[model samples]
Target: MGYLLAVAAAVLFGANGSVTKIMMEAGLSPAQVTQFRLLGTAIVAGLVLVVVDRAAFRLPRRQWPVMIVLGIVGVAVLQATYAAAVQRLPVGIALLLEYTAVLMVALVAFFFFKEQVKTRLWVAIALVLVGLAVVARVWSSELDALGVVLAIGAAVCLAAYFLIGERQVAKTSALAVSFWTMTIATVFWSFVSGWWELDASVFTQPVDIGGVGGELVVPMLLPLLWNVVLGTFAPFLLSLAALRFLPATAAGIVASSEVIFAFAVAWLWLGETLDVVQIVGAAVVLAGVILAQTARAGKVVDADLALTTGPITTVRDTAVP
Candidate 1:
């Protein structure tokens, strides 16, 4: 069930890319779109918390600082960076780069926690790099360096998301963590957006309120709301649940499916097509993800066992942060 939930988490995260792109194309700046999305998500997550887990929502005073930091880094920065990256980079390419947070976590463990890296681990990383080369069509052309940097920044922020989530996974409920984090993010985004004048060109029509236009005038689509609900809230909640059941690195690797799933969803929904080379690259990325998961376990049977039987017991939380 945890494995299925983790995969579902990936799909939800993937779906966000295509949907967010649509919203952006409608003229919303990445920051504005993210602010609106986060605001809506905060409302939903908060409602769920008040109704289902009110007590958990109230952290002790000592934990407040930790929660605030988590909210800033994990919730605000993690999402803001990704939205900005996707605004400039191809959604698939941007997402693939972001998913490299899996590797970042593993490296964090190796260098900081002194965990051992095996031969296969290195091979898997190599495979992913080679695969991404094809996916991004790097040899075909060069694009904006800043766009690439944003993608890398998004990946780093995502790594922080996992690392921070892990810090509280054992002590906190996933529901609580998600709810509080979103709440903090809402505060953070509100401040960021308070001074900025919203542009009128961000949507197809002026925003309607009771058949009236609001002062801001930014409009929206039905699908954009659906995107906020499913793409943003649902998947992130599932990821929090996965964080409860798995280590940061493991959750990250499993979540890598989010990118490939993004490719498929974009192809189907947004008419964003891919070439045979890109498909091959996606395949290689999947292979590397699988190889990396197995290599970390130190035994073929354990790896196969994990894939076949969901997350086995040996995929421990030790040394994971």
Candidate 2:
């Protein structure tokens, strides 16, 4: 059940990359799409808290600063950068860039936080760097430079989410952390999202759901709703529920399948196909990510892995690429 749940979450998250691209192509700016996602997630999480744990709605004063940081940086900036990257780069490549957060977390834990990481971490780092080089085809410089930068920025935000949430997850419920952080993200993005300028007719307009040369069409609201419900909130719950039955390391390892799913879905749905060399590079990077999932020896490694594994986890996990 745990494995199934984790894979289900990964499937949703992976496919979400395509859906996000669809929304962006339908006339929404990355900031507007991000604002909508954050706002929708906050509402869903808040509603869940109302039913199961109303106390979560009232956080202590001391935690406000951390929650604010998590909301603005972790959720807001992470989602915005990711959305922008998706618009400018292939979905799989964008996700691969953001997933480097796992590598960043492990290295930070080892060098700065003084956590005991396995020696395998060094091997994982080398693999990731080499794999990314191959995937990016840095020699030819074929990938978009600005898109790569945005994706890397998303990785940095994701790393902050993991490091900060590692401590808070011990004291707070994951759902509560999600609710507060997303709420903060929604609030932060509201100022910059220019959401008011958005016309309601935009959602009612039919848009091409297919990417590149495809022809399938749908109401823009359909994918937009899916982005909020199935893409973000549903999978988030699935990942948290999976944690009840699987160790964080195991769950994290399983969640790494999101990258593969992203690649497959993008190829099939968006016509974003990578060549044989890039596929091999992706495989190598995934192997390193799996290794990184288990490289930490500290007890908190479980929390760390849980939050950093899947794409679009919450504060205790992601709102990543």
Candidate 3:
């Protein structure tokens, strides 16, 4: 169930990038989209955090800096950058790059965090590379440089998210970390958004619900609601939980399913389809990620195999990538 929940979370989380694309098309600015995600996530995740960890919500004085940084670099940067990337590239292509966080985290685990890797892992990564090559079609004549750069930037943000989130999981419950981190992210994102640029108009009501703080005032918020609920709220909570046991890198590979989901969702909802060359390119990007994910902890002990493996031990385990 935990693994299922984690994968489900990855889907929701992964889909957010595509969701942002839809919202933007509906006439939301990048900053506006980010504002909704950051604030909406804060409200949803914050409520859950308060209910689950009300007793432990407050951290010591020293932890505030850590929380603030995590909020800015991890949540804010990741979501904002991803939104920007999808605005330019095909959803599947953009996603293929960003999900490379799995590889980035794996490498970090090896040389920095020092985690283990097995031989089969390398083979899997190699397959990923081959698959991505087929998907992206590297030999193609056309190249979208701007799209590629934005995608790479998104991946960088995801890498930061993994590294920072891993650090917090050690001392905090996933719920607590997610809640506080989200709250902080929302706050920072708001500051970046500037109060003048934000308005209630960003959220619209095509229909009405019952009542709220005053009169009957429910409105059509499917796009916005999904943004808050499935995209922002659910993903953060589940990922925070996953971070407790899974290393950032392994979590990343599993999360790579997001790439598959992105393509599927984009096609289903947006009627977008990938051509052969694009598919090949996407495969190549994923290939790099897999290679990084499966690489071993040691330097160069070249024998018969590269001996690539994923993280060993629980969150408790650490080694060179």
**Best candidate per lDDT, number?**
2
lDDT of each: 0.63, 0.81, 0.59
TM-score of each: 0.76, 0.93, 0.74
- RMSD versus native structure for model 1: 7.4
Runs in model 3 deviating more than 4 A are 2-4, 112-116, 119-143, 205-220, 236-254, 280-321
Predicted candidate 3 versus true structure: per-residue lDDT over 4-71, tens digit per residue: 65577767855666667876666666776777766775666567766767765668777788777776
Q: Model 1: which ten-residue window has the lowest total lDDT?
A: 302-311
Clashing pairs in 1: none
Clashes of 3: 29
**How displaced is residue 2 in candidate 2, in Å?**
0.9
Clashes of each: 0, 4, 29
User: Each candidate's root-mean-square deviation in Å?
Assistant: 7.4, 3.9, 8.3
lDDT of 1 by residue, 1-321 (tens): 566777887787777787677676666667777677767776776788788788986688877886787777766776777778877776777777766665665566567867676667687788889887877778885444677688778667656655555545446665566667667877887777542676544435544222112233345755457666877777766755665666655665676676678777777765666788877986786677666655544312111111111111223433323
Q: Rank the candidates by lDDT, best first.
A: 2, 1, 3
What is the TM-score (0 to 1) of candidate 1? 0.76
